[model samples]
Target: MAVYVGMLRLGRLCAASRGVLGARAALFRTWQEAKLQSVRPLSSREADRTSPLPIGGLSYIQGCTRIRLVSKTVGQCLDATAQRVPDREALVVLHENMRLTFAQLKEEVDKAASGLLSIGLCKGDRLGMWGPNSYAWVLMQLATAQAMELEYVLKKVGCKALVFPKQFKTQQYYDILKQICPELENAQPGALKSQRLPDLTTVISVDAPLPGTLLLDEVVAAGSTQQHLDRLRYTQQFLSCHDPINILFTSGTTGSPKGATLSHYNIVNNSNMIGERLRLHLKTAEELRVILPSPLYHCLGSVGGTMTCILHGATLILSSPIFNGKKALEAISRERGSMLYGTPTMYVDILNQPDFSSYDISSMCGGVIAGSPAPPELIRAIINKMNMKELVVAYGTTENSPVTFMNFPDDTVEQKSESVGRILPHTEAQILNMEAGTLVALNTPGELCIRGYCVMLGYWGEPQKTKEVVGQEKWYRTGDIAMMDEQGFCKIVGRFKDMIIRGGENIYPAELEDFFHTHPQVQEVQVVGVKDSRMGEEICACIRLKNGEKTTAEEIKAFCKGKIAHFKIPRYIVFVTDYPLTISGKVQKFKLREQMEQHLNL
Candidate 1:
């Protein structure tokens, strides 16, 4: 059968321009299906092994087989949930005083999808949905069934249209757009001209109208006609699970962010499994309220929180435009929110609120703590102070639909603190020995790898770079060094690249950092390796001391003398107020290393 390629331009094709351009569809490899088809039948004796690949003393595991996958597009998944509980509460924007039921949300989404169609966007067209967490943001995400780039990401992915806020607090999105497209000031809404962004044709603004941009409300209204509504349905009807529905940019700590293109299959199944692990099945059919403080641009918010909530017919509560601990606490108290999602730092801030005790967080039964390592102390505080008895920790990257392993609610506090839980359903994880090119034994540290539907379609337009990590068998090599226990729980030890080799001894920085966090005077710690001509790389620890506390590098070294191996102990200690962080709140270790190298003249 011949592959049908859709026209590249109509990701937002004007109504008048529909038939002027012929229908087109790109030919996809069909490799995934072909790989499945080529699987050879196993002999009775070989069937006992389960997996087709042979292994050594390596640690490898797959999720339970009993649970089947939900085969549907992201839009269709929402449609199913909305159909099941049309009158059920779907979204609550506490700060905005906005609420919507499943039926109402679906109606808005349909109208928005139609609006997109009326403006010329069609199936397979790239649309940039950029903004904070809001009801409209959620609508736009599903309406297009595909979603950022500041400029490079947009142009790299060939974004045809953009839907963003006029200004997010102080960030002037309109001004930035104008800088990129000087002609946008005079061009019509659907006829943008830009030397920098040649593929961009339309700009849709939220909340209010901007010069040379169309109001979001007008776009929705334009699609109110029956013809446009049918067009929206037609677009949804033809979408495939394999088609790319979203493009998430990786945190560019090491270099430029790679656009990890994800499909409906990649995220829909992942989120569904995540919901299952959270015990958010809603068998009683009652609404579960989840307060999300993470930005919608990140996968933790978009897929793990938003998409997961929709899959289970739960209410998603956006507490603030950005993370505000006080507002998050208030939303939980006032809305009786049962679930919460945030990074470990966010939870720390929430617990640090002076009046934190004043809020009634007794309504919270469970929550997800992710984005960064969940220190045991932080997890315990969230459990004890926040009254979240069923808190679970998760681990994954943006390239893996953001969630592959999640703790079961009933998991012991110790289990939750020590590991990132078992693999999610239908996913596979393995620990490969870095030097020998083989899987390692249980509890042995090695590079962690993941393979499943969640693996991305490869970095957008960078196949060579994509191949460097993702292998032919489809295993995406996570740079993280980890170990899986016999029970299948995985512990992230460190990053392979971040490992310190001092005098031929491998020293994992996370292990030292975890040890330093135990020190009473140390509030935060990051251990990095500084280049040294003598030992190759000497260990250094950057520490943030507790309030009103003072300590010397000698005292820190003395504390570690008898506790950990002498070689494992940091050779140098530097006290500081805070570590440099990325916009997403991850520590810029490379920056820390550079600063230390320059200071010490390494």
Candidate 2:
């Protein structure tokens, strides 16, 4: 995180010193106030085993290494399970010919480690795993863990040490490597122009070999497993609970995207808490077979998928490169996946498929859907039609390992239909008045503030950026507008900045879009505020009609009548084939806004 901040600082100072200082001062003030809000130091109750938690009392709840390094590292977590469930099938990589047991998977991880260590790769160096989620993808992450401990899991490892199975040979990779890490300065040496990182004293490849990167397989085979195993053990001794795994890229409402640094302890604990609440094999270790087609680059499929299954001695099914609806559905059915999880968009696509009912979706337990407000209609499809008993409406950000709220246990049908649910075990939430810069009371719509163990280490290389989002006491200002009921259920209304004011009335697009989703022909709809001369701004609906169907603006407007207020209905509707999205499958409203404004000549 310091690296990013330093670069931004250097860029600012070198480009324009006076403007840079002023911007920094303003940012620092915004960050300082946020920090103060986080560290308010509130009192709380302690939860543990025999403390009413479903999981056997949490062993690491009150300690720094509370969750323990082994429990957190993907390789270490799988290894622990390998020892206990040696014969149990731990992973089934699609098109890989066979299933790998816990023991076998650990061996693969060890091989990758030996390969890196043989080439003189030191501990705590960053290793980039940029390939698609596959058997080797999991292996790469675990293998890299053996060498680097927990310094870089979700983010790019910064030492320019190792690149993953695929997608790193491009110019983008080279630029990022050299720009982020100072070690690679003056990287383009003689014979290195076509040369892929000849400057790295040592580099290792995963599955295939690159010109400059050392072959991981060859290196691993040449060395002694016992020696590499000992080195792993030695590094594990110095592995602190809070060490970062990797850098994750997440979008900000205002900028391109920023890197979120996630630590081992944060990822592990959050997953543990999730498992406990869901009553996932709390009594005894069960053969919980989990299907993860959500992609390994993401927390939902990687950390959450791995930890949730491990907490119960379950197996992780990796069916990589799950393209569209058909691929995902096939993988889920093939694995007899017990539970499925992904963003709301992915599930919506799955449910909306023409073959939705054909698959044996009966084994699904439940799923967590975020990245956008989940419509009540979609939740009903997952629970009733899809046979998923636990359709949870969750909310969080990448900065917090992307989990903060779970549905309240005693929530009524109406509450669940209207809200995202309650705050999670180790987190606190409050509604902030963004305009007044004050915390608001219950039932009020305001910016949501989250603070807990689930929060990220910080933005990788951007300290000033980190301080801006993560306030004191570690509360992260989500920039999302929400409301907290008296029962503590936090319901997302929209992004704090997403409110489209039409003249004097505030129109939340999510609320209006919900009504449009109720229409049968409307497969997907995005609401954008278009600049209007008469109303200041008018609601615009970007609609994607169901296959072989169509709906006009007039008909859609009629359907929305009596469903929402008069002023909240969209004034303009434009049909489109697709919506622009972020990496996590979140719909980019800003993009939609730009598209509509240009179309209407505003």
Candidate 3:
């Protein structure tokens, strides 16, 4: 035993010295052999059933699995909604001053579909959209929605055509395209042979045409002139609910984003279900006007915000091209918007605006505050100040067409604020012990796993990677640590991978962040672990203070000293003006770690 220990020390010493390349190579080989000897790989069948214990009892809850799903195509759903409410306003772009009733919107959608078909785009063809939300954006989207669900990850999924804006505000999208396809300047609109993007044959531009891109209006006109009604009808007739529509990239807070490909059936039902949760019914005469400020690139915006509104014959009001608090406020007041959608940070910013009280947002009765868990204070403030009395919370990932859990209307303030509410109909969730990989008892903190109609087909073109998160029995491991009550309410605690181990102590950063949020100066707080040589990892707190508030790191530590365990107290504290967030409004903690590492020169 002494000789083995001495040999391990000698190998480490040799590997650390630059002159001993041969010894370093030998040491690495020995380490690899040791690792291989220590671990055994699970068989395919064993891996599928993660629970060694039985599947029944307190470990799982199948959410209304017997409920029937909407078995219609996206286009069919839109057509049906339009038929039911032809004269009702279907969409309103407040920024563009464009109002289209259901019938008019359907007409535009059919024309756009015909235009896409005329331009050689067929069923199952990939079309990429890159721009902020607008009427033109919606037209192009629904046009594509007729045949296919537009995916978010274009390059990874290898889209056949791309429809993007020539420019949006300060962003020159065309200029970036020129960099990728230098020959785009010389190539024809429909026949592009670029080295960078070989699969791309067509480039369609919204608002205006670029040198190598076709104009959107021209596409619509081309379809109008073509004798292709039969062809469009043929494509629609053969379409199925199970067909792949869109591939949304999971917001990569910890690692590289994976493309979660969703089917038409997946999104259509998910959107309708979410809409139902919002008390929207197409049969009702009361118009549900929704003010959406989130981006089109994410499921939160595309599925929950836009598609849900369309499915329920609700009038969707786009506040602005991008989220502007002022524009959102104005749209809600002017349009008499009954619903509003945004993240907690967005709501916080809107609440912080000095002239916020000046706007009359009395029309807003309900909306969703999703992407992250909303603080209790933020929820109360939104209800009290923003007039969102029926405001609820939604929780899910991009992989599930985005919503698996939601707070329903009848839920009390404490239930809505403390928990993410009950599971959606036709879905199933389970809590598995993180270390044991077996089912845990109810109310025990464990990894949350989901299975249902909402789960994506898989990560696009990466079956192995897809298999890693989604088990063989079709359960997609959420990686979120959560506790489920007997009544089925779930309180998300933290990420499984995000769990911090400091000197053998398990620490969940979310708990620390939640406690820190109670501090008077803290507007927002994110806790992460930094590498430490003495311990495995040390807790670091990154905080965004409330406007005009002042506090020191020492003050924060002093506050935590007596209230919480010493092991959980953040050793490092940082004050920042803002946090790095994904387009969907989720904080990118990995970016924070990188910044902290750079700041500490670790």
Candidate 4:
């Protein structure tokens, strides 16, 4: 999990540990006045009813649950919930000192959607949102799109409007926007005509307006007119559940980012299913408060955090502008937040706080631990120290609306710690032999593939690229090496792609190697991930310098300063004469990683 103070981005369990489940019933009773509708202890067979195997005993599992899928658009779902719980608190941003009821949040979202339309943003127009987690981020996320990787994403998607904060930390977003579209200096507000970004016409500043940019307040006010309101109403009528609603960037091995296009149907149902697993549907609006510290740009925040709350009428408390351990702890105590959403690393940060014991996090009954697998020790700490007994693990890629598997609240401690839980309701998962392209037997590791409503439509405008991962039958090849037992519990063993997940951010080694190849003194570069105590995995770059040329690690770090995300920069840089090679001359990255681990004593 990345934490940013200003404007810049910075970068579980054994069977014996199952003792905590002994008091599971008591824990639920404390959280809810009445008995929970579905908190009963479940045997392993009762918890996950994996379908019987076929004649071949293939590694396949289809989720079987009484709950049916919700077939409505995201906007429609929010509208229905607002009507049911208009007086209930829908959002609370503590740092911003902002709180909104369900009715008020719906009003704000509709007004913002109108504002976007008033500025010539029509249906299907791509709009990019850039900033820290805030009320504004949530508003724009529901109104339109949310993204990062400014220049590359803007150019790739041909965004019609870009909404960003004035500045974050030391990075001046206005200045960065100016660099991308210098015409902003001379053009009128909402009339940007840039030679570099021809498709981008409107620039929106969340803070004070800059030259040729419209202030967010101005956009919101513009929609107050009757004429704009009528247009907004007309536009909503044309919205469809299958229409693409979000474009999240995920790095590929091809050294460029692929925009995973998600539709309203994809996310709305996915979030609903997730809420069902957490038993959020059983709690009232007053009883469920979710403390979310994850950044809104990722799926964990947008789909898992925001949409789930909307679907279940749960109050969402923005812990802080960014991920701050102290602030998160304070929010739970002050707001009586019932659930906390974060990665294992985030849990570590909170648990390590010197005054952690002083805070009253007992209100936190459960949340999600995602991004990467959690160690058994960390799972124990979260349950024992933080009072997150119902916490569960989630697994998915951006392409699948971000969540395909999640543990039920009543699952055994061993299942929660060892696997990513059973397949979500209405989804199908199967493991295939990497080389044979055939289904694998149970308990055998293979490439995991998913087929269901959760999968993305395709990579935005990249048909060929989309075909590489998504098959004709709509099974998205996750490229994750996983094994599924007869009970349908899945364990991720490794990745087919060399994507280093530092914190929660995914960094592609090929992308970094491509960037390093541009360095003057670098002849070849190989990037790999090494074990990291806090970050799960840290990047280590092994470079072969050009003949008779030399460069220091500091020099390489300096070169990467503004060129890529700060998290992608290698934590360890090694100069090598040549990489370990096989008899056939292929570079052996495993051997290279072993050598680095020995060198760093990690």
Q: Give per-candidate clash totals.
A: 16, 25, 1, 7
Candidate 4 residue-wise lDDT at 355: 94
Q: After superposition, how far is residue 22 of candidate 2 from its true place, in Å?
A: 35
Off by over 4 Å in 4: 1-56, 143-148, 251-255, 498-602
Better of 3 and 4 by lDDT: 4
Q: By descending TM-score, how would the candidates be arranged?
A: 1, 3, 2, 4
Task: lDDT winner between 1 and 2, please give it.
Answer: 1
**For model 1, what is the alpha-carbon lDDT of residue 180?**
74
Q: Write the per-residue lDDT of candidate 4 for residues 1-602, one digit (tens) a residue.
A: 11110000000000000001010100110100000100111111222333333235678887766566655566667667777778999889898898888777776655565566567765445556666777767665631222324676677677667667788678687887787678898989888898888877887777786889988788777766778767655655545566565666652222345677776677777887788778776665555899988766666776788777877788989888668899999999999988888876577678778798899876778889886556555666687788888989999887998899888777778888778887888789999998899999988878999999889878777999899999899999998888888777888765676667789986667557757866867756778899999999999999877668988999999999999988889999999877664211224566777888998999
Q: For residue 394, what is the lDDT in candidate 2?
A: 67
Instruction: Report the candidate with higher TM-score, 3 versus 4.
Output: 3
Q: How many clashes in candidate 1?
A: 16
Would you list the C-alpha lDDT of every candidate in the order shown? 0.68, 0.54, 0.66, 0.67
Tens-digit per-residue lDDT, 504-589, candidate 3: 99898878877887888888888888899999899989999988999899999999988999889888998988888765567888
Best by TM-score: 1
Kindly indicate the candidate among 2 and 3 with the higher lDDT.
3
Instruction: Give me the overall lDDT of model 1.
Output: 0.68
Instruction: Supply candidate 2's per-residue lDDT for 576.
Output: 91
Q: Indicate whether candidate 1 or candidate 3 has the larger TM-score.
A: 1
Score candidate 3 by lDDT: 0.66
Which 10-residue span in candidate 2 carries the lowest summed lDDT? 6-15
Better of 2 and 3 by TM-score: 3
Model 2 accuracy (lDDT, Cα): 0.54
